[model samples]
Target: MRTLHEAVLDGLPEDLAPAARSQGGGAAMTGPGTTQSAVSRGQQARAGRAGSVRFAAGRALPLFVRGRGSGGVRPAFTADALRALRARHGGAPVLVRGLSGAVLVLLDRQELRQFYEAGPATAPAPALGAVPSRAAVRAVIAEEARHLTAAATLDLVRARHAVARAARRIVLGGGGGGCDGEGGAGEEHPAGLFGRLRRRGAPEGHTPLGRSAAYAGRQGQVLRAMDAVPATLLRTLLLLAAHPAEQDAAAAEAAGSGPAEDLPRLEACVRECLRLYPAVPDLVRVTRTETEWRGVRHPAGTTVLLPAHFHQRDPEHVPAAHVFVPGRWKTPGADEDLRMAPFGHGPGRCPGDRIGLLITTALCAEVLRRRRITATRPVLDPPGPLPVALDPRGIRLTLTRR
Candidate 1:
């Protein structure tokens, strides 16, 4: 457990760490010292000593486990708990400032408004490196949704077609294939889409989000284009998806640092980025040989399921821990995701990372350039990709028309 989490922490960039650390190496000043970090009496009451307690990189898990909540399962911390925690602590940011050492007071809510912000500690001039132009980022963003949505829809349509074809094969015992198979089921005696698919051996699996017509048309083209992209671009995309803050800093670094200067390797940052907004948080690790994590003894073949979303919010690894602050990824241990493996580490990290990153990076860049700035979209829970992982209270913006 210790080694796994440690590896996660080591690989992460400072942006992955959610909490602010001062130049003095102490916690960043939040509000006035009310100590509003996510640690709370209610949280402790919720999480009790049990066989399992999910802890973040630097956070301490509860001695007692709490009752299960939403998402068909218990959330590490419920939004109500966050609101309640804030209320108990005295307003939002003010209380959050207290979570570390002394209570902190940042610029006002309006001043601190923006989807992404750079702290004083974080701001440094970009190193001489190759940077994407403002126009290129814009083009990618303008077309990203079309491509991603289309890819998703096409996948589903193909799946549905595959199923229908399979049913035809069943009647003809592998006849010419399924375009005609549904006819045999008959307009009067329908076998249903699922039935047809089962006959074909799941050759065409569809994801739920692919319901729109527009989505279907664009997917194949984007995926094919993605196939031909260089490995470096793909790697850049995935790393950006998993670590937005790092992407921001990296872009700056790449431009000023040099054409091929020593930049932060993206692997560790990917783990942390997924920690914040995982594509698929369910990762299971089976010990081929016996291994011990965090001094806990385990025999071989231990199937350990890591839910990065839950662990990312744990106060241990991420300070402030609850805010949707991407800057959290910038801290040292902030980059770790031992218990928070989103793509599964080692050989099991996500494969479609290139596609995922391409979509995610394009989306973020668009927002930064187009949307008038402000604080993070008001989120009741910790950060995760909106709509995919956690549905947020639509990202409210105090925008100035650009």
Candidate 2:
């Protein structure tokens, strides 16, 4: 926590230094089942360490409690909850209690870096797991593309099913139980890496074919990370549609580019969409020990909620936060914006970020080059945030071949 605080202090801009100092005062520590001020911060910190274990065992009360007006849930649709949090707590860490009796520590930008970049000495150990082979993953994506091209009209159902089927095949193999059996004869490779893995009956943790519970879980996480793609992709298409000049620019850019091409305009469109609707709405982690960060004392065993949705859209960090402007990404420091965590940051960042971006951008470019897509309904009506899941509705597009 001390190291994190110093890092934040060092990173603060010259103009923002005074504000950082004032807000850097440590968080007030509250003891479990005790009135505020009844115990010293030192005592509370020690008690917090012992209480964390008891709390994990479901035997002790949370050492920290939620902000009074937080109402057990954080609302993503409206600004009320966030406004109340900032108004009542300033920059301090706000604790919010969940209906399940879980207490979460919600931290802002500076503190979040501390939480994410904690040194190996304080960081949690990495889970032992294997990722899907490149060939297997490419096979799944190719199958998904085939499905998309075969669809009569791209709607929410079809789009979601495409991604789900591909992800499942990557995780469980084409002929495994995870498959829907809709794949035709040409879809399966007779002696592919995945084929042999399926035949071997991947147990739980060990599978060279990338067929295991751990691999499947990671596949599921990736699919969830891509949840907003359909909607956000549709939105980006609409943006190009609305601005015919930009549409021409995009088409020209698309014609000259390949999948690996990092076209600035195309990237800006995707970046703007992510800024508005991040793939992962929130990031959750548990504290290993009672720690003070960004002037806030968080008890051990606290569930830390870094609401990336709120952070990326926060008005303070992003100019015209609610408005969608692809060109905003052209400004200096835009790419390095710390407030954005679409793929997360630091050591625990998603390993598939580059791959995901490549896949998404490539798909978008190909679609634009071949057909003009128009949304049948409003694509921006976000059906509220669902933490790790993307809103499943609000996107339907009809493609007209060019």
Candidate 3:
């Protein structure tokens, strides 16, 4: 008779089932210890399967412990875990059980390129024409910079508030109406609009009273801008504070900027920051159709996960993976690299990427232009191995006027 572990592996693909069965050992006999033993055997059998790795539930605890609350260090913990998994399993994609379900983690950069290239087409990013002009965005950044400059010290909380205000103005236009809680009577606020849209039921075509396409799109833009911009800004600032040489170079560029896009060094710094600590560290997608890899078939609805944080920092592919090297971005073909997907890739890429980058780079330039920033809370020495995880909330900077 087959063991209980073998029976469990029976549901998996033919290619994987046999490997699991062979390692599962003999049939189990009923006893008080049987259930626990069966589970351990099953796990071992699962791990033994080719092209996959099984992690004990406890192995995922660091993700939970470190990756909670504001600026949780989940990405860092996850990258470390992925590095270990890759080292043991080689470059092949490994199936790791996640909190939600089975996740097929993509390890190879070439696989990542193919996965993104084959992704289903999504709606094109919203038109940049709808956004406030570049000048308007810069004005908002300058205003917020004034607020920060008045203060002797800057922390994540203050930084977030500044970004939020600027995001509101840029996305909503005309000072963002009432979203910042200072609008006059009868002005519409994002929160109020969001509530109304929520009450109206899903997006257009989903329900008769659903939010209109225009309203839904506008609401989405506002929310994404508000949430993502602050995170990017904080991370970039922390990175700049930690690397004085890069910071000085970026500041020199910021001081001579013709437009946000013209500031190459500052943009590189922001890009490096995103690569190091992407706001969205992991990308997950559900297989719409059955997908096959390395002679194994994954049925439809399979969860495919890309730990971008790991791929972007993999030492084999990315030189100075653990170091802050802004100049790498200036190298030819760097932008075309699929491994460094800070915003994401292909059709599903973030629609507001250009605007978001503009906002972040501009704000960073504004801060660095005339203020010397030093990180006080976490001491980061440039030549040493940078910490895998950085908490934005824990970041504190002292700004001295130049």
On lDDT, the leading prediction is 3
Better of 1 and 3 by lDDT: 3
Cα lDDT tens digits for candidate 1, 186-305: 122213222333334433336433322222222222232222122222222333434456555544543443322332433334334455445433333444555433223445654443
Candidate 2 residues lying further than 4 Å off, grouped into runs, are 1-78, 102-107, 119-152, 164-178, 181-228, 330-335, 379-392
Instruction: Give the candidates in order of TM-score, highest first.
Output: 3, 2, 1
TM-score of 2: 0.61
Number of the top TM-score candidate: 3
Better of 2 and 3 by lDDT: 3
Candidate 3's residue-wise lDDT over 181-227, tens digit each?
66775444544323344445534456433434555465566556456
Error of model 2, residue 160, in angstroms: 2.4
Model 3: per-residue Cα lDDT at residue 181? 61
Error of 1 at 107 (Å): 36
lDDT of 1: 0.31
Q: Model 1 off-target regions past 4 Å?
A: 1-141, 144-274, 290-299, 331-344, 373-389, 392-401
Model 3 gets an lDDT of: 0.62
